[model samples]
Target chain A: MNEPPRLGDLVFTPEEVQKRVKEVGRCISGDYVGKKPVLVVILRGAVYFAVDLTRELSIPFDIDFMSLSPFRPGLQRVEIEMDVDIPLAGKDVLIIEDIIDTGLTVNFLVRTLEKRFPRGIRVCSFLSCPARRIAEVHVHYFCFEIPDVYVVGYGLDFQGYFRNLTGVYTLYDPTGRSTQILKAMGKGGKR
Target chain B: MGDFSIITISREVESLGDEIALRLAKKLAFEIIDREGWVALLREWNTELPVEPPLEEKEQEEWMVTVRTFLREKAEKRGFILLGRGGQRILEGLDSAFHILVVAPIEIRIQRIAEKYNQDRATASRILAEQDMQRERFLMRNFGIDWKNPLYYNLVLNTSFYHIEEAYTLIIEAMRRATNKVPSVPVKQRSLFEEKNFLKERVFFSHPSEEDFARILDFYGIRWLYEPRTFPLVWDEEGNVVEAFAPDFYLPDFDLFIELTTQKQKLTWKKNKKVRRLKELYPDVKIKIIYARDYEHIVRKFGGRK
Candidate 1:
């Protein structure tokens, strides 16, 4: 009999995650030496990641937020909804995100942010789950590449639970395709 | 035409405004847009409602994060009567919105609340006072509007004098009537320009072509009513009643001011005597007398366009 596999591999422990973010911070600070930078963080899910990323930086920068959702009441197919508008004007902006799962949210945000005529913009994400990616996004810096799974813990939630966990984990579903993929493949290397 | 998004109600409480809104929802087949609707139905901020805004910096930082979350999910095409949030100001000039204000006398409001809450006059009064405080704060802090003012309302119907059926009829009647009317400024409005913020131009234009004054104001933007609408009749304050000339056109911003003109020679001795007497009492009174020649020059220069 084969054992079930974990969705989120041990890409980095909490300490490693912190170090990776610091490296991204150093890269950003060097690039934006004399520019007026406004870090526009996509709200809700990005709050935790944004906090960690900003803390890594030593440079003085302002922060703003915008909220967008693909799901709305009357629409069946996914579409963008803009909320909490900000005036980006001429400042160089950087978007810090938690995860780019489908890459839909990040792509939509970048395209829309470009229309504001910011001096420049780049994206940073904590996780990029490429195997599950449907939409393409250009990420400047990211910590880990996660597998396609129902991820939870480390501020990620499954139905608003498990957001306070110290490390990321995946929940199992009996009928999940990712679980089935693991089963078909047999005992693989560590998650 | 598109799905109705908002129904802004400027109601004086205890007038069955809530019930009427419910009934209107049934009549028009719409839902009541409360705070719950703002959270559950709409997105712009996070789902968690803030108990209080921050007094300090770091706490404020987190508050803003939640605020953006709330805005992200705002209702696109909601159908409901939004009561007392000063919702109209939020929807300045949206074409798809219907705004209605309900009002009533103090006594009737007091009576209604007293009956509904099953409380005496004193408790009802306290409840009303608390509600008014909340509304006042909400309007001032959230919407930046004076809720007590009737100017905030589209159609102010007094519920103290009128019953719910009458009020509802008015709500429906107003809705019916409103549909026929223009959405934003009422298709046919009283103000010619509907000029909310009419910036004053540098040049003073006080002459007409018939008067032969032809100076054109280079700075002033063109308007349909820019032509000299009235002739200046210079009045000298000879009579005990002050004598002064009125400006050719009424400028709503100023008081007792006149447009200047080079037609000093047009003032006859009789007119000059009255002007002198008027100037003596009200030395600062603005009397504009335009030269007949300036109007003629404008017509000649502009190829008789005016």
Candidate 2:
């Protein structure tokens, strides 16, 4: 039997992640001091980041969750599996995402939410991957900017595994390309 | 229309050609293979190839073959309306397929574009020019023929003078006439205008900033409706008087309305106040204001400006 893909190297330690999340949370609180904002957490991957970041918010805010069907070949449209129960009209909306890569999904989300007539809408992601962006979506707030690399852990997964892991890690690359890239970024080499 | 199962429509931008094709499709109960349909077909056939038609000559040749084969197979099963993508040339000699060329006077096309995009005549003219050049070049490069040459098409339609319903009825009548004709005889090509009379003019845009914004949206394949809807902000005591706000663009895919303001922050207060009032009145309507600085950032990020 083939062995499962191994966790390669630590990209962000638990402490680093928590610290950045807290800082981002503080910034959000400061910026939205007087207004009540809606933190729309993208389901599955972003749940961990949303929970951690929301806990650090000093101001009052409402939380909602949404999930989108994964892109499949031959499927002409992306379907919204779970929609937020809150009425978004006349409310400030801050979409919480684990990663903004390719910008397609977030762009779709923003467009979808825009139809709801939110007072204002913005994106706040845990990680921003500009290198992989195919759709141009503005990330108003982000904790960290990451390079184009396959990363897992901290709610990110590798074939449904590694969500339980506390820190972000590089997925074990047998070809060593990812390991080399991560190491150069001063991340990997921990295992 | 003698046992014809395929109708290929080639149209200039803002010619209402697509609208005519759609109406014909519904009336005839035929599948319409337009850009979106073609993309879907391409995706299903070859998952690796990009959905947009390839630009390289050799690659385009291969792409054309794939498309032609797909169309042939599809026609075998049921009738369909093939819109543009050099369909006229792709199935030129096919017995069951009839080709159409839809055109309009440059001024009329530009006027239509201006109204559709909520832009001024000059801006509309510029857009029309850009789109015409692109279409001309695409046909020239792919099919190696002047698409405007009426000889390639069995019927040439001038939508400038005809309404969409009228055009649709004309096509259906033509098809009925074709059905009565001898199957072995070649249908004579009809030219609505002489070659010299085929004057190509451009479309409209309201502002240079808006034009750039539209280009970015087009580049990303985002569908947008220009000034599609207006919301009432104020009403008189008798409910007869009114104040209203029309957003600049509505993106159907995103369900968002975007209003681009290139004015300075202080100058934008009026627009902002209108937007706030609009939100209060139409709580279900989602709108966003793209201020000058924000617009510049977006343009910079997307390299929208030339």
Candidate 3:
């Protein structure tokens, strides 16, 4: 008989995030040197990460965004309820996102994009918190691995008001509320 | 609870518009004023009426003649929550009744059709489209107006996303607001014939009851031409003409004025002002009546006021 292990503490400060983005950018540049990769960023939440991630890659790229509002708060669903379409058929596609927490929203995006039949599909997320990651999701590249604490900021919003923040920061408020915020923000979490 | 009694649901479809309607006969209150029943009634009305029924009973005859006298009598005495037949227009003069239009978005309606008939979404969409066409045709033929226009209805509800129970709650609320119940007109049944005829004139007739006003001229054998008050006038306190029910119905033959009253409620000061304004705008036509209960009978039956 064995007891399940408790989540241990982990941290990746602001500087560490920039260094990871540079590395991710290098890998993206090397991978798609001559090809045009269409980057589809989901709106309201992923604006910041998509911008930073695209900045790192030095290849010819076209950018588009899809906005959805299914799991706004107090709900858990495995579908992106609403989205504006992006041209994806026969073209190589890259879905750049902010974070992958519960992975439901991301999974829906993957399934939906698969239906459209892109030439190739890949996901690049800025942060990955695997302890909370749900099954059936694959993020091809990610920035840093950190212990699961609900974090916000860096274009990620808390109630859509805080996305203006330039960099990521942890909640100094109730950890439970932070978790609630995470579950809420987890709507568009990684994939 | 009773269907025949023109049941006003206290809850929504989720709470059981269908369930209540289906259960009504067993519950034995009245006939279910549901879709099939409503369609049957409409079909029967369509069977009796000419392609387009007249506004006044006089304007309609032969096939166009409806349960005219009965509509007058039952309107004052009946208790049914008249579903979708333009029945509201027929019973417009009555003050104690509740006239409501139950509406849902295309998605919810599509979903319900799919679930009810156990058909595919596309099939359901097609069916809904057909029903909508049938309804539009019926309204055009019967009321001489567009059914989707909210002005003709006492209440316009968005039932698409609402829980059936929430929808029912709204209907119940309408019953209350209607207690102040702006003395609404009864609903009439719509048919397809009026639709084709209206198209000949190049007018979009959406309300079933409104068809009465439009076909008034043709039915009466009167050479007068009338147009629906497609655009309503926004008015002031006094009954002075200041706005528009604009581009009034043009009746070049009779040199008479005719106004369309979708329902039978008294012309409010605001509405009166608009009507007066319209009258002033077109002085060529001299008549100044709602034709709420006139001229139509003559067109249908070639007779006097019903």
Once fitted onto the true fold, the runs of candidate 1 whose alpha carbons sit more than 4 angstroms away are A1-12, A70-73, A76-86, A173-191, B1-306
**Regions of candidate 3 where Cα sits further than 4 Å from its true position:** A1-13, A72-85, A173-191, B1-306
Candidate ranking under TM-score, highest first, comes to 2, 1, 3
lDDT of model 1 at position A134: 30
TM-score, prediction 3: 0.33
Candidate 3 residue lDDT tens string, A20-112: 788998999899999998888876567777777778888989888775443222332223545536678888888887777545456657757
Model 3: per-residue Cα lDDT over B1-306, one tens digit each: 211234433222322345533443344334445546555655675565433355332354322334444443443454444455565544443454344555666667667777889987666655665455455445544555455555445555565556655655665565555564343553433333343344446665555444544443333223333353333233333222234454334342223344455444454466566667545643432544443332332232112101
Candidate 1 per-residue lDDT over residues A1-191, each given as its tens digit? 74543244323356666777778888888878877578877766677777888887778888887765434223333234434355786878888787775454576577567767888888888777775443346788787766554555555654455566555655554445445554454422244
Residue lDDT tens for model 2, B230-289: 565664543322577778876544456788899987899899999998777556556778
lDDT of 1 by residue, B1-306 (tens): 234456777666675677777777887766676666655543433345553333222343455445433432333534556665545554434445666777676667767777888987756655664565455445433332345555445567776677777777776666656664555554221121232112123224444331222112111111111322222223223211122343343222122222334454446455455556545534544343333233322232223110
Worst 10 residues of 1 chain A by lDDT: A70-79
Cα lDDT, all candidates: 0.53, 0.75, 0.52
* All DockQ scores: 0.01, 0.02, 0.00
Tens digits of lDDT, candidate 2, A1-191: 86877888788899999999999999999999999999999988899999899899999999999997664433345678899999999999999998886576788798789879999999999988786554569999998898766677777776677877889887776768677777788777874
Q: iRMS of candidate 3, one decimal?
A: 31.8
Q: What is residue A23's positional error in candidate 2, in angstroms?
A: 1.2
Docking class of 2: incorrect
